[model samples]
Target: MCIIFLTSLLLSPARTHNLEEIISDCGTKLQTFSIVQMNYDYMFVYVNGEKMGLLEDGRLALYQRFPVGSVLYDPCELPPREVPILTDAAEYGVTACKLIPYGHYEAYIPEPTTGDLHPMTGENVCVYVTNLPPNTTAEMLGRYFEAFDMVAEADVFTAPSGECTGRGWVVFQDPSKLLMVPPVLEFFPRLFIYTSLSDKIPTRTTLQLSSVPEILVPGTDIASFAEPALNHNRSGNHRRMNGKASGNFLKISNAANAGVINASAYYFVALIRRDEVEKSVEEGVFWTNPANRRAFYATLERGPVIIIFLLQEYPVIFGYARLLPDGNADKNGFSACTVEWMKHHVFLKEQDMRNIPSVPISKMGDGVPLKPEIGESICQLAEQHPSHSTILERLGQSSPNNGRHVGRGAGVVISGNGNLGGFNSVGGGGLVHSVGDRGTLRSGIGITSLPQPLGARPATRGGHIMNNRIPQRRRPYNDNSNTYVGYGGGGGSVPPRKL
Candidate 1:
């Protein structure tokens, strides 16, 4: 019996589920965190069962059933009575974990095992993945895919010349036989899953624009001063397919083709300083408080959100990012937001937000109460600035391969459209291999055979060619931003091929 007045959900959508592990002076424990979305206005919070917990790898672990219990606690009592801890397999989760003041109440939700989710199978089950991190390895990825299902085999993408490419495929085995879950990745990585099978799935390649209300010099309500009234549109046209929040979201892209982010996704302002934002970029992760989920994003729907970095003491807005919702939690359980920062640095100050709020707001997940409104203003300001990609555009940085260079040995087309775009080359086997782009790999001397171009029977290691053809590996979210897909073995690095 959980009677929850789900308020303040406009600026921040109510979390469908959550995961919380608290550590106190009494004893360390793993449990679902019970939280009430704070309402500055009238609020009612009653809980008698488990909470929807968060998955360690940025997905929600929704329980099949609701929480069940009537556990009462005595604040005067030093040691509270023990409650049954819940597992992912458990029908319900427990949110009645003990909390003590003087003791440290740290939060962490350990990553689940392969058995965490039910198994999936098919006749020729293959997964196509792209936008992998720089440090991605065959071994690490083998472990990562185990969460989805049984991996029959993990093969590195090798060019026709035998050089490994950045892109690879994981083949799932027959469900009848026992299979092992690949070990968990050493570090959590957020690579985009283009499709479950290597084959192409229908993707919507156009933007479905909608009008969001103006966040102007809007009036502030004194009665509801506890939380700023959010001003945005709810009449979005949404249709999801192939993991995309398709048909109804704002699809904005930049010239560099860096990456197209969803402008309409839930935006937020975190009370972080200039130094912290830079540190996160350097460390490649942004940490947020999970218990106070205004900051945690691991379980949020996968999409890009506008993020504004506000200084804690100063009214200064320092930086901004098109934060991808594929955020993860650290070993200690702090939520890490994956941010793709904008080049336009903000130095604006809002006088109204100079002083911190007096109301009892979440200090850890605390972004200012008027954060939603502030984010809207920042989005308008950012729209005036450049709109190129920060990370996704890096894929197209490779210099085009063209004439004048001669080679007697076999060449591997691992980058830059895989085009043997040269006519003056000494020997031409026409053996131009690439991860994507049907563009012919032209050559001079010996053009033995032209292997299949990308999007048309991609070559595999063990005589297994992939029919999982995507016309163009379009970003699952934005259909407009398409670049010739190529594999970079190590974050877009091209290696030498043998003669």
Candidate 2:
């Protein structure tokens, strides 16, 4: 009877306990378990018939369910573990592996046939050409790739001394064209091409503007607002069609004039300093005077504002943004509006502003249309000026090809004294001349001196002026007082002289 009772007790099932009870029993002396799989929000462990609980902080709890055929052991009972994954380079002959968070371990395995080790494919369609002739240059490579219409940029690697490194890269404007590049190009002598597609590209810094739906701001018509600014003759056909006006609202010209619209979009080109724009964008707050805000909204009727970066080289269209209606008065006594950045906006903050030039837009005439060619001109200017190259680099715009002159001789110089200075054959001359304190003087051609008094007649070549209208005033000499009279370009001032 005793043997039968012991057999029955041994065959009976073990009682299951909740996680709280298990934690009470184990106390702090619990063994950690490795997670094998997760099913129905429960973590399964490698130990047979055992499941683990998770804490609120995403950590595995000691509470576990142990069923039949399961075995639990302390840390000392486990076998020797393998070395942890290494992130950096290791010593020679040492086995090393990198642990990528949330990545599969098998992804690092090399392909048996190709021996390719990269885990992710590149996004750029750039190809690197190696083993090239020492004389191979970027221009030469660019010409060679001219056969491919999509070739956007080619850069040849050079040493610090500016010598060729026999290696270069070619980038395609369309990333899909990268697949067309062969594994090797044998067209050129001694040239071996290798796939070196980069997964990363330069971040775009230009602002993106989206048109706000007209329904958002009721009773305001963009077309009507633009009608006063449009040239009626140029937009006659656009007005005829639909009789109500349709087609692309922004485009000004069309070949047949059938789709042409005479409505010109009105925008307030606020001349915010680049530093101020950057700070506003960084802080996510844009401030303006209440009067300015009213003018901006009233003129465009809550339309999008075309923000331009007033750079020293040129005015660049940074991006487009709409001012939120919920403007509030800030501590600085200025009305503030929250700015929403468009996609792929450029960084505008904390940049060197000493080189930036401020624009006096108020002096400019109103209803001036923002020309598309202006943006193109700015882009061309950026390529020519080294100081403005950051704009192109940030925008990922390709630099102009070698040996191309970017309007170097096309600049005109006009002096404050109404003197026109012509550049030499290359248009590089400046319009500056030293002036005597008494009157205007002429130096060489296109060079004029300053300090011409108001209402004074023009001076002749011999420095004699014909002042026939006004009678000369005789003044008492003040030599003992050490006072002297000097003439400025606009007027005269009393200059103190040493006794």
Report the number of the highest-TM-score candidate. 1
Q: Looking at candidate 1, what is the lDDT of residue 402?
A: 30
C-alpha lDDT values of all predictions:
0.33, 0.33
Query: What lDDT, from 0 to 1, does candidate 1 have?
Result: 0.33
lDDT string for model 2 (139-208, tens) is 4554344333223445566677666587776654334355555566643434355545553322211111
Q: How displaced is residue 171 in candidate 1, in Å?
A: 44
Per-residue lDDT value at 219 in model 1: 28
Tell me how many clashing residue pairs each candidate has. Answer: 18, 5
List, residue by residue over 1-499, the lDDT tens digit for candidate 1.
1113122222245454332311131122112222222211222121111122333221222222221222223233467443334454453443334333222111112223211222222122345555444444443444344333323334444455544455555543223111232222212223233333432222422222211222212222112111111112211323233333212223222222222223234444455543565577565456554432432242234233555554443434455665554535554244556667653344444442334221111111132212223344454454444433232222232233432121111222222232331211101111222111222333433334222112223334455443223343443322322322243324344433425
Q: Please give the TM-score that candidate 2 achieves against the real structure.
A: 0.22
The TM-scores, one per candidate, come to 0.24, 0.22
How much is 328 displaced in model 1, in angstroms?
A: 6.3
